[model samples]
Target: MKSDHSIPGTEEAPELSYRILSDTSSSAPVIVFFTSAVVWLLVGTVFGLIASFKFNFPDWLGNIPALTFGRVRPAHLNSVIYGWASLGIAGLYVWLTARLCQTEVHWRRLLYISAILWNAGVLYGVVSILGGHSQGIEWLEFPKGAQTLIAMASVLLSLSILRTFYGRRVKHIYVSLWYILASVIWFPILYVIANLPFYSGVTQAAVNWWYAHNILTVWVTPAGLAAAYYFIPKVIGRPIHSYYLSLLGFWSFALFYNWNGIHHLIGGPLPTWLISVSIVASVLMFIPVITVAINHHLTMVGHFGKLRYSPTLRFVVFGAMCYTAVSFQGSIQALRSFNEITHFTHYTVGHAHLGLYAFFTMSIFGAIYYIMPRLTKWEWPYPVLIKFHFWLVALGITLYVISMTVGGFIQGLYMNDPSRPFMDSVQVTKPYLMARSIAGVVILIGHLFFIYLFYLMIKRKGVKRLTPPWYEKAEEYAR
Candidate 1:
């Protein structure tokens, strides 16, 4: 391909220029999000691999408290959740809100501050955990200083998105904006209440769990689901299945997801009413989950053929289905008998991967697939590498999730027997532990390949020269 302008090798295309203009103003934030996410993924996976190995050989590495499983596991989780997913979502929120509201980010410096504060908070928290300092709660393990920084960062991010909605040029304020805007409001409340120092013991525990769960549904999920609501319809050239149903999905989730976190402690020391309320909320989440599933399925129903041809569509569809699967699994696992068999095992770890990786990360992956080429004014340097990136990680995470799920079930079931010794159950899960470590390596390689792909795009010298760059499909080109 030769550029239309007098420039070195690049595609010649007009539409690519507009895509650049629409996207590049926000490119710095996007790049910051992705660069930080990749680094976090690497950091988290190293910790995750160590955590998995610790399962099989508890003292293989060291007996030091700083390197112990307790510390490393939280480091792993916070890096993945707060560092990767939350940063990615913040970036997506900025991009989506700008598109919907037809407004450039107001006070773009705030976005830079938000991104910097967020990265600093995550880095501080991960380092502190490895230094054997943590709050020792599930999700709020970050030290108080780090937690406060993160909470403030969330305020900046929330305002960045909400201001757009307050001044949207788009008449109808699409369902995606509604979902994301509501999520911004939901997050500050969730974080502030969770960080309150007054609560302790089981009350503290309940609040912690509530914040943890909502972090997924209210923060990471809405960003992901909103992206789905936007991209799926746009990619397929159709409206969402029903506007009213979209509203229903957003409201149902807003109402129900807030209280669903305590079901994790179904039989714990917490009040029966709190756990019971959480259970009811968890179950009611099905209304929103199923409704969104129906809307996506119906919107995508006649467009199935496109999935075979479009890489972005394929990944997004897989994520959409995984959303359905993970949601149903969460609801089922919330039951007392089910949690009795699955809680606190590798089963929970598996479920987390299914939702976080298979569902949420897949959507992020799809969004990148669609967004990157547009920004760079070039297609993927190598299609084979692109396809390889998807399948390898997809297969790797599937093995990771399934092996852990089965191993966890065996561990949980054996542990409940009381007669079976704890060490014996650990012996049975050794193979699964090894499998998970190996899968971590697989995903690590997949991420490295993606980084290379991105690097190639960024290094090309004649980006603007490619006025009308290659388009994967007519619909994408038309945009």
Candidate 2:
């Protein structure tokens, strides 16, 4: 890691920070986390691009077994979740906890072991999926061995984290820390419960959907949001806009999100009581989502201009807004009438992307942009590329969301019309699928650009000169 500082009457110095965490020592575990995340981001992006493309150009990739839409969709999803999202967040967690707790990572010996086991589980899960070993479960489609391995590794990771938190430097715990703590606490319970066997098909489906949505609400969303709560306010140089709103967001979500998972099955064979309860819970979630949204928006009220200048702020606010949109849409879509129309359509796919990609992934991108400079002790090598990544993904998602929403409506109308053939209804979705595929390409390009830029940031031989991170409208170092 390196640092650059300018004095009023002196030349800038490009001195490297000797520590990885504190610029003291190389932390291979951290590097592994980052490397795995980057590689998988590209991998997942490519598969997703192919899957989206297949909707219109069904034979674009030929009939290759591994490239089929059915296969590619789940494969891409697994890579994105296990390979990119989980690894990055876990890596960040290890560092963040160590820093906050003011202690070296507790299980130094398990560093390589946990990394290997975690990655091995992902590898197995992905390959088994391609081999048609999926359990046909929504999110838990991975092979049994991979699932258990992940559980085992998670246990070890959680232990280390618990021990780390037990030895904290600060007396007052921050909101972000609480989120992280709750996430780890909630995850293992959900993971095991989701993996358990059920007596009936209906019960299994209910449990699977529960595990799937909860992972987002409890695991990925929390990690991403924790980053938001800490980084957004810190970057803006202010405290949270509403402390009450913050607490409201946390408690409301905790109470509602886990229960709302059944909403995904509202039209299915699940008990009427279950679906009814889920719909109410989902709608009630608007309380928490709005609370978080208002907190972020009000905090950035006067700082919207900063989005034009700070890549970190710009992309983060983009994500925060998307979070608002997703939450609102989610609460509404849980209504029975709406679910009847939107279920089993590209519309549902688009909604998930809105929450997972536009909201969570964008926030993580912002976190990386800001945190990497400090963690690696190096500024981004190509700032312009960062801007390209931002706009490409932003525009891509916009098109994706709009097109799918429209197509979903068309799909629902056709489905409701008993006179129409199912294939005819599916045909109506082709244009939307094609649009989403194009969006995927645009996003993929953005990913490749960032991967390259990220590489340069770490390359010791990368351009020796240091420059300020890029922004839409900022002078040399203004952003």
Candidate 3:
């Protein structure tokens, strides 16, 4: 990666002590992890579109058992969450670990084996759910056998990361490493505890939401934030505004987020005190959200112009903004008053997408744009495709989220009104549901384009441009 201290009169140069992109042993697993993730992304997109279409055209699949909305929806969710985001996060973990530790991966073969086992577990889980073997939990729908495989894979990966960290060449660990390492620790514990089959009835429901919510907060959100922390500074050619602030954000998140997941049970049959505690925890999460927002946005204070020249900057900043928006919105949604309107409505669906797609998934996309080129030693085949992928998915998700939000609001209001027939809400929401279908199509197109571009880069078929697109000095180009 190139550095630019374009800001004049900077007495000390930004730190370039980190090593990156030269560790083929580490890069190999990243490639496999990411490539498998893209395949799952495409599969998840198709399943998501089918689910959207079923909202409007229920007979489109003629009542096939596997194609039913109930089954396909969970299949889509599991596929994207486990198959796509999990794999992408694994890839990010590998790269971040190697770079920060300043060492080649110690157990490269184990990472390779873990990647394969991880994908296999996710595949089996998705298939089992569609095959009616689901464990009937929301996020832990995967059967115990598949869950065991995933747990084992996580254990192996986590051990590899810890070993790398122990051998780190740098004395002072960056804040991003804190997040990356924390996620590795948090996920396996959450996974094993949540997937244990001992609980039933109300307890099971509580455990289910606990796993689902924390999977997002502890696992997915941390990976995305880690990437934003690294890439934002790397692309902007600056250190974070405050390392102390970043540490504060990480500790606050670790402390509050574990208690926050229970808020998803706001109106359910859970104890009032538990619910109140969760509400407070959710609200406390804002402290960290604000800290992160300030750290990232403040670091980019004068480098907003770099977005024009850096694809990674654009994707990451967009994701960082979404993280702030989604976290704030989530805190509000956890409130009893706000949950009264949004709970059990499509509004919740839209909110989930806001977190998963706009925040976490987009962050991974940005990291890929930055990491893949270095790993493959080839630039993206077409800068235009990069632009296309960005705009298409951006527009698609915006439309998708907005339509569901407006439709859900209308649905909730109608549901609350005594005089309105229940079907009235459905009638009014029909248009928005259709709009979601359209948006899904647009997003699918973007996925296809991204997959093609990824294939080209992996094949190393692009022109030999060492720098990112639009990254050239006028003098050098003229020569």
Candidate 4:
């Protein structure tokens, strides 16, 4: 009897051959973006560790203005958000758009230029922040010059994506493409509006939070969700359980998420009606969250076992679950009653990490694991290193969130009490802050392992493999 599995480039596998061609078309730009993302991830991790330790040892770097927590914290944030997440998602946008559209990437030169400009912007922004030239807005800390470079890069990148999407050969667009296309349209507009110079005082606060929250909604969340929607089903060899649910999720997310940021201003100088509307929108987010959870869970119904074998499945699924978890937590946090306790406390810090690190970063990690082998035509050097990388970060984030949450809640209680001294709240959080520093160390080590592995794979220094790196035989996986 002949084997049933068709090799990817063989005559019997026209669809697979087309996919190989798409990957080939996307390889160069994707490699550059992914490489830059990893470098930024390492840089951001170091900055984050320093910031975390400052909570426990504020005087350690107090003499060095550049290493002060105020500077280092935003440096860490900009490096991770603009450098790591943006670059990683840009790489994914190129590859996923080509694969889904069944066409070669258009405007390849623009993409290369975009990558260069984006990296330059992030580097400039990080250095400027360290040198105390920040814009001083929470999320928009980058100075105008840095923002300009990033904005220009974003426009070029968006043009390339739109061109590729316009030339698509496929008639029916995938769910992933919906998010990618929407993000491409939404982000540049959001970025341009947020960086406009006129706003000041309370208006600037409103604009700052609006941009901070929408950036995650329009850019990071969509990228993470798109990766989950594609990789989960792709690795498990199944279509999404319900196209209707996916449409519902996407439309509802678009409808509700834009209004969510104002809820952060529940007790601020903003108009009462505005804050109330934001709360309603935040609660309404449950509609999309539940729909997406169902869609992913149904798709994975019989495929849970695959998580043990496929690293892509493992990281993506973990991220998907975290998406549900973090979204629910956020909805709860948006409530005025709940926000009163968690706002300005370490609890918010934990929640931010859950969404950004556990959900978005992990999803991107899974994407890199799946896409790199295809792009480089080389397997990951060591499976053990990958496992260590996953567990160390997982454990680190888990510990970090738990410690901060418990300690923060207690701190919030002390803060609300009139009799207690403010120092009591600060003193109570000391141990948790120490734990956070330890967690940062663990995460930094994990990142080091990941970057080392990435370097080896890029250099093609690993043991040669004729098969994919699934936990089982490639033949079985193919079948």
The number of the candidate with the highest TM-score is 4
* Highest-lDDT candidate: 4
Residues 110-205, candidate 2: write the lDDT tens digits: 655767778899889989988888888878888989988888777777777777788554566777777788887888788988888764588888
Give the C-alpha miss distance for residue 408 in model 3, angstroms. 1.1
What does candidate 1's lDDT look like per residue over 217-295, in tens digits? 7888887798799889889889888988988888888889877888878889987988888888888889999999999
Across 157-262, the per-residue lDDT of candidate 4 in tens digits comes to 9999999989776779999999999999999899999999999988888888889999999899999999999999999999999999999999999999998988
lDDT (tens digit, per residue) of candidate 3 on 14-133: 232233322444678899999999999999999999999998998989668888888898899999998999999999998888888765566777788888889999899989988988
- Pairs of residues clashing in candidate 2: 2-377, 18-23, 19-23, 19-24, 19-25
List the candidate 4 regions with Cα displacement exceeding 4 Å: 1-12, 464-479
Model 3: weakest 10-residue lDDT segment is: 5-14
What ordering of candidates by TM-score runs from best to worst? Answer: 4, 3, 1, 2
Q: Report the C-alpha displacement of residue 80, candidate 4, in angstroms.
A: 0.4
Cα lDDT computed for each candidate against the true fold: 0.80, 0.77, 0.85, 0.90
Q: What TM-score quantifies how close candidate 3 is to the native fold?
A: 0.93
Clashing pairs in 1: 12-468, 13-467, 13-468, 14-467, 14-468
Q: Report the lDDT of model 2 for residue 29.
A: 62
What TM value does model 4 have? 0.95
Query: What local lDDT does model 2 show for residue 36?
Result: 78
Candidate 3, number of clashes: 0
